[model samples]
Target: MLSLFTIISFVSIRLAMQHLTSLFKCQVFTALVCLLLMGLPGQSYAGKILVYPVDGSHWLNMNILLLELHKHGHELTVVRSSNSWYVPEQTKHYTSITIPTSHASNLEDPEYMAAFLKRNIEIRSRDRSLSSFVALQQQTLTLLMEAHNASAHMVRDILHNKELVKSLKNARYDMMLTDPGFAGGVVLGRYLELPMVFNVRWITNSEGHFAIAPSPLSYIPTIGSHVSDKMTFVNKLKNLLHYSIGQYIDHGITRPLYQGVISEFIDPNTNIYSLMQGADLWLMRVDFVFEFPRPTMPNVVYMGGFHCKPSKPLPPGLEEFMQSSGEHGVVIMSLGTLLGSLESEISEIIAAAFARLPQKVIWRHLGERPSAVGSNTLLVDWLPQNDLLGHPKTRAFVTHGGTNGIYEAIYHGVPMLGLPLIFDQFDNMVRLTSRGVAKVLEVTALDVDTFTQALRDILDKEKPYRENIRRMSQLHHDQPMKPLDTAIFWLEFVMRHKGAAHLRTESYKMPWYAYHNVDVLAFLLGSITAVALLFLLTCRGLCRVACRKRPRDKKTKDKVQ
Candidate 1:
């Protein structure tokens, strides 16, 4: 198990032994060789790693990371449910640790996700009113409840499996790599006394930063707030309200869901709301290039656009279609994996809009074909999204504002026409729009005329979107190192150090008042008030004594007269 440094040093010593023997003793040379091997552990021999990943589209990026780990000769063992829809049972990159699970039209079921999206679209498309907003909040709560319940069930199964627990301990994984969106992995990592590194943007309850770092509501917009960093007074108020709602969901819906399982299975004293915050390292899936500038932690590493890369050759016939667009180039559209479908009327409008455009269009349409689809449009069940976005001919992107797609667009410098339907897409689009690289349209307000004009504006050479996005792309590429490589470095850094306790903040262990210094502020204010009151009393007493002395002096003067 020689390291890169060891191999080079050994070769140099063998070649220069005659010269070295004249300068140093044999023991010195031996010690130098040992030091080379021991001190320069360029990754410490790729230690064993355990992965707990989320399924569906989330698995796609996690798989990329796992493959990279495998390339470095790290052994990976992934924990998955039997009902997982995306994670494969077998892969050369990692061994599967599958748990038995039962499901019917529920979590990981295509129908369930489809129905959820459908319901979300319905709620969002409704008129803006109190009832509608309330309904949306309720829907969000329900979804959280169901998702955490399923995760808790899987966690319980894993913990209760006596044989599996013993096997896990015996295998001795160096650390746990996971998506903190689910609490199961965090709890388990603690149980095994293993350091944790999170591949994350979202946690169980809200955004990961809100849970781990000092996030100010003044500028950091909440997810569902539909606001930006440079917010107006009203917009700032909206952000605060939305953040409060998020806290409500975190406490009311998510905490309750996992509280029982955590108390019974993991540590009883751990708080579900902040459990994920205790991870040794956070490999943030986004960076300042895409996300707005905000306070971040030392352990939080930004690796946005890590999955993006130079365009490879397009699939058969795809290059021909892209080339056929000529002067106008091409427009690409994708709504992401789970929520790719659109209503019949909306699809009709979008297709009609595409038909009028001179540029050739490629849409990742999964549902029924639209009647008004253009002859120039290519509808595929799936497409090489990164390849197409990275293509030189990709003039504009129409997307649902998934973080992956947005980052890919940013990486390729592709301006966007946003149709943000649900989840973080709405806020993601808000950021893009504020940057002037995107045109956002309300789903309910979308029409053939508006959709056509928006697409045309993005494709128009005179528009600033192209230039703005190109600038963003430049900034994203200007990093000292690639995001993926940086992620790997930190991952290995954690393993080499056993854990990054120094980088990790202990503020997570403190109560809210203590963390915020509320108690400290209260004590200081009380001390100052007490000192002021005492000073005022002494001044009043001196004034009274002086008045009494003046009266006595006047009476003595009268007696002398």
Candidate 2:
């Protein structure tokens, strides 16, 4: 009896072991299936991506984009000028192709380019009154034509480069991501026959109410529009004339060179600004945190604070520097890329303003130090801007109101003292000032006292600027999805969808005047009047014939009688 019981127990144990083995196999199969499903190409990963940067600068806003692309598992390549200087932090992972650009014989270096631009601005300003505006427009046209020619040469060099052309020819990219400000990339994307995506790193025209190819904030001095935007009837008429003159320059001058020189790469019909409007998607680096309510397209995604990355511990020396700045907290002063390394007089004015301030100042001075340095002020050639802003001791920002800077300040919920130098800075400051989150200091007119007072006012604890900025910061932080994630999602979405053609707007199909439907009323009146005149003429001819025949009838009646 004992032997029989042992046998049964042994058999039971063996059966149970077999059952467990079968269960394990089933689970293993399920897991393999799951992995396959997860790894299968989603709708988003279908094509190659080409990213063209405006220039190689840390401020180009390409770093976060590259990171996002990596997370999505897509390949990207960048086309940049041979002379480009990209910061490692911004371009560590991406593969780049250097194209030869005949930008100008004079702008051989960045410093030279900076001085050249400044001189150009000064010359244009001086000639504004003395020169016939039309003559001035013609000169501007000549410059644009030259720029287009330069861009064309670069495009041809890129297309003809044996290895480069082979790579592009072999790679089946669905879309091209480009910053339209760069004439070369703008023209190149048009020829690629792939869908274009615009990353408006700065403010573009509020779509619909007006389609400014670039941002339209022109009230600020030094970089405002040469054209007028006055509201009066005469001013409106003058603006119309001005725009016509400007278009003449762009078309009669710039476009001709692009066609004659660069036409080989792009289709004859495809052009830069015109083709840009037909882009499959647009990512505007605009946050509701900084810019106010404005018209934007349904397809236009606002990914303003996309540049913010995971914060890391501050460097030991930097941490100590901040700690030494004391309890009131330190202020970050930067004039952004365009205004960096300004003239000595301008730098002195900035330094003098800082000397008056009581709070510790950390100025990102990219040039030589001022002759007089205050103990309270610390000058660094560069700082990890986003990291510094994210720091607790960062109390306020003194900026030139560049779009990126404004958005960064908003992301950190820091108040601003704006010194708008040019371009869309005026519009950016106007929005900030209206919101009471910033104070605008027009650099052309601001005195040291005015600048100091503005900074002081913003730094005051009770000031609404601080409170308002806090509110905006909360809103910025409380976003449904982080800007980077949103950017990645769309970028991936385009890859999966093979260019997101459904997102493209048809506004470009209409002519400039037709877009506004200005001719509709005239068309209706002309059609109606033409039909009425035809009917009137027919009736009048019939009446005249009857009148002449009546006399003949009377004569015939007399003969019959």
Candidate 3:
């Protein structure tokens, strides 16, 4: 009985030891799997992204890009002015930090922005000659300077806020994303020693483009030139002159203003262009379809339609209006956020033109309702512009040719009749018109009859415009991923590759003459000149020797005779 009990006990002990070994192996395997999974793509790569936005439209553009990153598990923090646009409630992943500044608040106020724009428009309307253009440039520079001053104050406040800076430093943000419109991002990024990605809102300013890549003034049009890559001699001359003027303005006027402001917070030696050049990526808000074909650096990514998204259901009123339009369809008219309302005379003319159309007009009017608006026109304080354009009933769009508006119209295949009111809108309109996708009307010369005729031309006579827009729309959408996704992928790519410094072009570091090889041309010219001079001197010396030898030979012959 004792031997049998001993044998059973030995077997049980062996079984227990085997069980323990298996359990230990299972835990080790599980840990290995967990570590492997954690190291895999899309598993453990969440980064904190900081955004600095200038205003509502700027925020709107950045928000779309950040939303995608947020959806992918990145944390986003936005630093904005107190009076900037309201943050959407659905942005649960976004944290907003406000800089307190009455100047910033007033700058963002619709009335204030509108007033500033109106003064310039009034000046342009009164004088349309070269003087007017110069004056407009001066006025624009003044406004920009004022805005920069306000932004500088705001940035100073943010920098001086020790608590905020401490918290931000503690957070250890992975990257800084900014519009670069106000140039505050450059200062902030430099101060924080963070890699920056510039979201250029429009076609890059000529000087800024020169600082980043090879933007030849001969072919590449200046920001407001309204010319194409293929230029006439006169246009090329204009482009060169325009570029020169812009450079002077930026360097002579704007640079000082930015320097004075930015110097207060960061190193006074660091200029805005240097900070901009140091950026890891430049996400230009332009595409080849709308912009002229030009050589771009690897770090520059074209994200034209980044703001475009799948259309949501329109508001009840807007939906009802669109559905009721039946076969006539609908027209969307908006001047965008910058201009709150048109002059009363211009408004009346636009209203008169819309009244004559068979299509229903949904005009975004902020001021008092125009008395001339007919039954066919629906005036609203705001409109879901993209959603309306996506609607099947949307036949045409009358707009200020803002970059966002233009992209939205192209995305939805809606034809446009553009009345450019300010700055780059003129160029945007000209590009669209050149592509056979839209007609541009001069607001200064706007009359009821001309306005109505232009509207009719786009809405009724211009079938090709619709077709061209459709084609462009298809081209814009025909990509490996949507533009928003493309932007997100590139953003994440920068994060994954640690700034993608390999993609930066050497041109960014080169001086203007060196970048375009003007120095090489000069060197070749100098060499040729030196060679010609040496040859001339050698021939002259030979001639002098021959002359002296002949005289001596004649003298010797005469003496012998």
Candidate 4:
């Protein structure tokens, strides 16, 4: 084909040369060559992006995304609170746009997380008592109410800041990238009227899918349900109840959380749920390998392990420690960024459990050392989690089931022993456990023996966990393009095209009745009912006429006789 195309080009060049001098021939040939090369793609212009990131682990992943965009020559402006611990005010990758610190952003206060974890641990330790359960419910709701109210205040502050608002309006960013875990970013994005993209897993109310996609309660497990996609009758019943609870939170709590802010800042008539659902694109931090197979949308691009990369070099001492594990291999433990550390009793139990193991352990501890220290264990305030997970001598991961850590372990094909603390952590562990990969130990029931057994179970060569996780890893890595690249490509696509409205669903604009086609169903049912009634009435009238005719005919016959 190349030779044939070359011959054709030569013929065309020859035809032109016949009417030109030798000096002009070279110029004509070069001109034709240049025209042929025009089919190839050219460089695209850099786009301006406004980022409104959720702090903590949410910021961890969002920062990775923005950095990649920076590498691609895009300008970024990150909106943050003055008191935000996770989102720094100064960064070389993006310009800072700070708003006044308020109660809304303070829901992310570190002390709040510690107290939340402490309260949850205390409640979980109760012996199936009603008081414990009540306490759990009350604390959770109180915390949620506080968080939502705080976020609303954050939104209000952002809107009321005339200078900040004016700067943003003047910037005219191509897109607004945000985490929809809180409605602060979502509300601001709508007010800015930019092409919004959600770096999302959970929305303000529930998991992001529940907000926009078709989720069947019978199969798609709700948060904290501790059930899988495949459910027994009882599990289905439990899932339904959890779904109802989610709905209550969505309506009773989450909606009202943002209503006042929306009314004052955006439009009075705008529904917060509708505004959240109206994003042009959702860069979902999810993968089918890690998640249940559920319904999704066209504009939602799943990039679950986009933050994961090839393991860079581990520090010399860490590498030596990993090497010292020899044939037994090592175990790495982390509770994610949110939880500082477990209660002392739980830590001692974990330490004792690790002490019993022959394999070396590297624990990322945030508090005072436990008394039951193991000779083989090395405790650090922080470790290169991805590097350790991807290490050849690393046998297993002991994690709190944070999505980032889960994906990193998945990326490395390391089986996990999960000690889920709170929030979506328990549910995240359930998915992996159901897949025959990770083993989960309830934090409330954490004892030395149980933790030891679970750790050994995942590390056992005879166990299918290693094999199952390896298979899952292969599936994750088998993509045509790398997950991060795919994410950035689509994001840049949005910037290049201005917005992804063509891929977005207009179902967001439809009311609940119209979205579910309930109105259409009602009309069709009504039409059917009317047609059936009309048919019945016509039949009755015909029968009555026949009866009347028969009687008249009988009378006539009698008279004639």
In terms of lDDT, which candidate is strongest?
A: 4
Structure candidate 1, residue pairs in collision: none
Query: Please, what are the lDDT tens digits per residue for candidate 3 over residues 1-561?
Result: 569989999999999999999999999999999998766546366788888876756666877777678778888888877756544433476987877767664446667678877887788888778888888888777766677667666777778899998888888888899877777767787788787888884422452355576667778778767787778999998788778767776687657766865677676766776667888988888777877777778888888888887788998878998999999899999999777588899898899888988889999998788888999999988888889989999999999988898999988988999988877788888789888899998887899899988877777743688889989999888887777777888888777766878888665566669977999999999999999999999999999999999999999999999
Per-model TM-score, in order, reads 0.87, 0.79, 0.84, 0.88
Off by over 4 Å in 2: 1-47, 56-59, 87-92, 101-108, 116-147, 160-166, 201-249, 252-254, 510-523, 542-561
lDDT of 1 by residue, 133-252 (tens): 999888877777777788877877788888999999999899999887867788788778899999998887667788777788999987789998999999999998988888887888
Best-first order by TM-score = 4, 1, 3, 2
Error of 3 at 231 (Å): 3.1
Candidate 4 local lDDT, 1-561, one digit each (tens) = 579889999999998778577658888999898887665433375789999888867888999999888887889999887778888888898999877755745445778788888888888887668788668767867777777787778778888888878988998899999988877888989999999999999876578898888999889998878899999999999888778777887888888888988888787877778998898999998999989999988999999999999899999999999999989999999988877579889899999999999999999998899999799999999999999999999999999999999999999999999988877998999999999999998888888888999888988999899999999999999999999999999888888888899988888889889998999999999999999999999999999999999999999999999
Better of 2 and 3 by lDDT: 3
lDDT minimum window of 10 residues, candidate 2: 219-228
Of the candidates numbered 1 and 3, which has the greater lDDT value?
A: 1
Could you tell which candidate, 1 or 3, scores higher by TM-score?
1
Per-model CA lDDT versus the true structure: 0.87, 0.67, 0.80, 0.88
